[model samples]
Target: MKSNQTYAITLVEYAYGPAFSNAMVYSGYYEMTGTTAVEYVIGVIEGPSGILLVDCGYDPQHEVAGRESRAQNHIKYQHPTKVLKKAGFNPEDVSGILLTHLHWDHADCLECFPNAKIYVQKDELFGWIETLSMPKEYNTLKVSVDICDIKECINALGEDRLVLLDGSVEDLFPGIDITVAPNGHSWAGSLITVNTKDGKYTFTGDTAYVKDNILGGRHDGVSMPNGYNCGSVKNVLITMQDILRLAQGDMNKVLISHDIGVWDCFESITTPEDDLRIAYVAK
Candidate 1:
């Protein structure tokens, strides 16, 4: 079946920072010569149904902590709402948020889009709660989990704004399908595939850090697992393999959330001040 519906998929870079470390971008397979950085982006699918954000960017406070903890050397944080406005969108115009998982960087902005319903994996919500309930030591080691973000998700749930998924895959909207990552980079991580006029575009939210994780590590001919797998290394590898199959060997169709190189892969627009950049893949 051919989809008459089309979407202009845009990647908005709301924040960026020096890579967690040289190893983060290069993976351990390659030598850490120096530090590199990665951009944190939120994917936008604009279609007849309105704007559907794949992941909402984080709050600015987290960027401060991120730098203090050495999680990143520098951070340039911008409110997703403002960033969206610069992209010609209003926060109230958003229809839904397809959250990959509840990591702080991806879900902290939940309150920013007040009118949008959140689409997330049921397992991811419960799994994160389970993690939060774990011993302080264990939870503290998982830097990706932010208590404030968890609270925000709980608030959304309480407000009955979450459309939780129990299954592995679901047709979210016209020409859009979201598949839960097999094991997931985190608990129940998700990959969103959009059928645009250009072709199927897959947004692998942290499931595959960069092309190297799917194509094979940069220097070595082996696939490397993501650094922060609140799940398991084995699960990450399995998920990576699944992502490859879903892409059907079309590299351009797979978009990794944190990869800075994404800016180069699609048609992009930069704001007049050059503070924000949006890359699009569409007809």
Candidate 2:
């Protein structure tokens, strides 16, 4: 018989970024006026063994490539260590990290968690490494590769702290399983599905930017893909459909990492100042 275990998942907002409305939705026509800024978050899974972090939020000083130009007006960043502490977790307490991809914002803070082993899709790591080896100008024009962040991951691998996945769905802890996104937002993004008292929750890292990306379509019951897809748009649509199917059609179970609306669905904790907030804590 299969053992029934449950874990609690929390969404910790560490940074904020601008998102274009027209870019987020799928429409044949383009409207370049309105934009909605969204939050950058990391998922925390608390289980029987220990705490597992989905993605490490970017370090405030990493100088996110294109973001620098608009940094003054569009970006608001916080160090992951401080953010995790505010959420009641110490950086060193994280037992493992389930990286969706090797993007700078998601993987740059790996060094903060000294005791945790990092988990990533094998293809994602190799593809990123190969891209990094290309001529700087060519790779910069073709891809959003962050050499510094990639080097940090490489150092972790050298230290025997990296765990590579062969693109298979497997249990990371008692009630948490990691599933591969058909074609990643980047190369090979991964999703974390956790069984909680409420239901099954899948942390979709950039695969689906917002809830609408998975539910919005031309037809009433169809699903759509996000505007930004580095891999394949076709794969984005297929991945959205798969996530909905895995959630058994319950949209609430599909937790989107960058959706600000997520705060409304969960019980959130925030200070009176309202500048910081932690969403979805088990009561």
Candidate 3:
């Protein structure tokens, strides 16, 4: 079924930093050396329904405190609102936010859009809640999540602004649909596909970090999984295969939110102040 509406998609780069090569690809240390520059991004979809965000970028206000960090070198951080405003869009007018997953980097900034309804996989929420409840020895499992973000979701639930999905949903909004890949990158990772004026583009959250994960970089014809997986590596493979199938074998149609290479594939404009970018995927 096709929606009567089509959107103009934009990829917003709010922050960036160096990421370990191995963190991007499983056992990448063997063949990959040095850190690769990566960006933290969010997807912006504009259509007749309203301005919708794929995933909210991380919140600077809650940066991991008092810790010597390895991946904490992220810079040029800007709230989605400020970034959107600098790019000539009204941040306050956001109507909804489709959370691909609840990793702190993706969902911590939800408070920025107070009036927007949040759509997330119910299993994603439940999975995190269950994991967070485990003993401190299981802390490794909780590394990528923020308790505050979960609290914020709970608050949204109380405010009637959270829409939890049991699984996948088509036409969540006109020209927009959500696909949940249970136990993929994170505990219940998911991706959103936008049928836009140009074509259908899939905004893959953290499920597939670099093209190598989907396009087979390890060997001539094999897809490699990212290094970190809160779920299982086997599930990661399944999710990526599903992503490739959804893209219909066209790697160009899949937008890897963290990959720096995305800017090269699309026409992107950088904001003057923060040096953030907005890539027009469809317009």
Best by lDDT: 3
What is the clash count of model 2?
A: 0
CA RMSD of each candidate after superposition: 2.4, 2.6, 2.1
Which has the higher lDDT value, candidate number 1 or candidate number 2?
Answer: 1
After the best TM-score superposition of candidate 1, give how far the Cα of residue 252 lies from its true spot, in angstroms.
0.8
Number of backbone collisions per candidate: 0, 0, 0
lDDT for each residue of candidate 1 in 25-78, tens digit (9 for 90 to 100)? 544655455655677888888888788999897775665335443446445566
Report the Cα lDDT for candidate 3. Answer: 0.80
The lDDT values for all models are 0.76, 0.73, 0.80
What TM-score does structure 3 among the candidates reach?
0.93
For each candidate, what TM-score against the reference?
Answer: 0.90, 0.89, 0.93
The Cα RMSD of model 1 versus the native structure comes to: 2.4
Tens-digit lDDT string for candidate 3 (32-69):
65566677888888888798888887765675411212
- For candidate 1, the TM-score is 0.90
Ranking by TM-score: 3, 1, 2
Clashing pairs in model 3, backbone N/Cα/C closer than 3 A: none
